[model samples]
Target: MTTENKGAFYTGIYRNLFKENGYSEDDITAKIENTWNRMFHGDDEMRIYSEVGGDLGYMVDTGNIDVRTEGMSYGMMMAVQLDKKEVFDRLWKWTMKYMYMTEGENAGYFAWSCGLDGSKNAYGPAPDGEEYFALALLFASNRWGDGTEEPFNYSKQAKDLLHTVIHKGEKDDGYPMWNPENKLIKFVANCEFSDPSYHLPHFYELFSLWCYPEDSAFWKEAAHASREYLKIACHPETGLAPEYAHYDGTPNHIRGFGHFFSDSYRVAANIGLDYEWFRGSEWEIENANKIQAFFSDKEPEDYRRYTIAGEPFEEKSLHPTGLLATNAMASLAADGPHAKENVELFWNTPLRSGERRYYDNCLYLFALLALSGNFKIWFPKEK
Candidate 1:
């Protein structure tokens, strides 16, 4: 019921971690803006977005030399939360123009990867992208009036996308993004397992209210399913979760993603945001405590792949700065003794400065927006 009547609106009371750690408000805001400008418009080493033909742009995964649904949708989510419609539209345009598939069993789904030149690298859609795209489009429709155009019809696009996500295979070629029986999103349209980091309860809670009436119940069940699903996917003592897991919560090793690594970093950030948005459960508080405790003593540069049970592997983290940012984001809901320590660590860490800066900077900026309360849902003025 929290999502009805425009849903459970954001309170805009973000945790002032910087101020708590002796920073001025102006300083924090300036830092955030500076980071945003640098990430979007700075030199090659600093920026991630590339404007293609006049109206379209793509957020490239600089290190991967390709565009991914992950980065494109993430960029849109960031744009909407920051009230940057231009950036949001550009990314969405490029996605629809190039990555969207219009034929065969995958019609209406986005190809997960594409070359920088706008050619498809794969045909399979990644569910993470669809989830983010739906939520961001809904926010866009509410914030900026839906324009009279194809992709610009924001709410319609959102609703249609959600409809496809749930009913894709009802009488056709494609598969639904979620498992009808379990109500949990799949790692891919055809996969039986899931990525722990893809479970975003906060997003699902809102979807329950905004989605088509016939499927409203499905989204509500999805919210409950993701919350309980995370409880088991994450380790009780360390709060570590596998990058991929079975529906029953055990780590899935089919592709060697069972260890906590790059993708696993989002679990903490998701829990933090879910708690901030809904204040729905006590499990989040405990989960936050356990994860922060698990990494309280490890140096950021030393981050590595680890088993959900807390055993570290020899593999180094591809996105250490990102991992640190999400850990700091976790401080939003964690009332534990080590929470401040984690926030301070994140404050001291600068935006990543190398080839892999794309993903790292994206997560870094989100943490900044979230912790400062700038990442928010916008509403249209009542007529």
Candidate 2:
């Protein structure tokens, strides 16, 4: 599946999957812009992003009523990709002012959660947020030249953060985000297990090229390791992966994360993006097809927690919109019978409203961007 002339990283030609499938370019552009406005500037219940005073801003986890590193980092990525530099800088400022951990084992990492008033809710960091933050900052550095100020020095901030992520435990001060031996990212800094959704080989591909020279080899190997890890983590027939799994890809069963649920939805999206960007693995195409086929006839309203083996549970999905969005995103890699149908269904589905809209809308926007050929790698300019 490694096509020298097809993948965006190789050819700089991103496929607009929507246009290929008959969605009008005007409608797609309007949808993307309207969604962005609604999510960032809409009324209280609709907007997740909030500007604090003059400079700082944050994304609220509406259901939890807290500011999470996940949302903040995601908002940054969303901003940078859309060329909304003001929004991106505000989110980064708020992250540094409130979430940055300065004097602990988790130093150099952002605290995973905080109150709307900027009080820490959790001191520990989530590797998902850290990885996203590093990539977003690097993209910012490339798209808009870095400033001379502290956090505004985007490239340096990203490189420094990545250094801590890969080298934190060298002197026993803290644990690194990734397992040194296996090269797979952990669910959290101190955890032994991995979240299948956290294994973003596309991001790692860029990290390998853009990170400090000394750490480049580690990231290159990590990209390969994550691709192989997904092959083991995802079910062969259904393509459902557990939210959390052991290093060998077995369901970890801790706190009942062994089953497919909310966090598990991102696996499909990640696979689609990795294939779209690098085309490093042919298995991605097969896996995406399997995922779409599994949900092709199922109603999002009837979405439920399921075993990776494809058995349903009594509980309904909390973020059904997110589930649909990710499945649609899989269309980027999938070329099977279900791919086009999935994308069409997603285009007709309305944005989720109310308490849990934060996560669902975030995934919704990302799907729209990818299918529209908007979510892209911002390579540094040649001197």
Candidate 3:
């Protein structure tokens, strides 16, 4: 490799170290403790756990409870990765007991949100939460094996919930919204939000692994639909995707925070190799490259700092815009000559160490797992 390449390689490694270093012993311990306290003893009147920031910051409770699910799941997985078995065990128990089960119309399937006191405040289902739960449970199953039973059940429930969505086509306006009453699909939120990026591709992968051979086509279709929507949502010039878009894929009226973030990276990562799913050609490869190039050309300066015309991108921290750049590098499929360097920049940035909102942390965890190749439930052991 040339000098520039060598520098890039070290940069990438440095970013990983920065991310690893951010979590001091105290920070990790406190997060684990907080998760445990909230899961078990935080609030009893609500019957669900209370996340700290509701929808805005670290402890967001999307009506589906996905924010908390991903938070706790990532915390436990991180503990396990660090060989903190006791912490992992405790988090596992709390999630399995209180967080896993759903009540009301969504009974049997997991819910999206619960009250601070552990009561079901949002009695709806979401694909993002289901996908995260599936991956987490699959990890637990493999990590603990026959020694534990929770992972097995959690994984089963996740798969079942996904099956329900695929078969029912349980969505409105070309997106999967929530049906709080019957836990069925309804149009509660914006029609074109990118929230499904959480598990669209994983759904296909999981189905291929567990579902019968004849039933694999359905999962593929679902993944394709998600990819198509992404292609529609992506801004041709800036490569940034809006939080909500029209069912036809036009930018919705609501321009949330107005900067690229981890959700876009998640969608890009999931859409990898399956370029044919979008334009029926290799356009996805080019699309991925376009997004990568956009980020690479403007990163470290343009990152998290958006501008319209001459005005500075005033949106500050609605989405932690920089984190998505990190995730894009860490997760998006490399296509261009600068792909590795771009990935390195994203992986090496120390932005995640700062205080973050709920979704920000969840995306950080997702980015870390993507960079480490730990996101996949069935990835081969590193040699």
Give the CA lDDT, 0 to 100, for residue 314 in model 1: 94
How do the residues 1-383 of candidate 1 rate in per-residue lDDT, one tens digit apiece? Answer: 33331212555455567788888899898998889888888888889988877889999898898999999999999899888899999999999999999998889999999999999999999999999999999999888879899889998898899989989989998899999999999999987889989999888878878888987999999999999999999998899999999999999987789989988999999998887777657899899999999998899879999999989899999999999999989887799998888888888889987689988888899899878767675555488
Can you tell me which runs of candidate 1 are displaced by over 4 Å? 1-12
Per-model TM against the reference: 0.96, 0.98, 0.61
- lDDT per residue for candidate 2 within 1-383, as digits (tens), equals 34554689988888888898898999999999999999999988789999999998999999999999999999999999999999999999999999999987999999999999999999999999999999999999999989999899999999999889989989868899999999999999998889999999999989988999999999999999999999999999999999999999999899999999999999999998988888868899999999999997799999999999999999999999999999999998998999988889889998888999999999999999998999999999888
Task: Go through the candidates in order and give each one's C-alpha lDDT.
Answer: 0.88, 0.93, 0.45
lDDT of 3 by residue, 63-180 (tens): 3343355555555545544444555555555555555544433444445555444455554554555555555555554455434354435445445645554443343222233322
Q: How many backbone clashes does candidate 1 have?
A: 1
TM-score ranking of the models: 2, 1, 3
Residue 253 lDDT in candidate 2: 93
Top TM-score model: 2
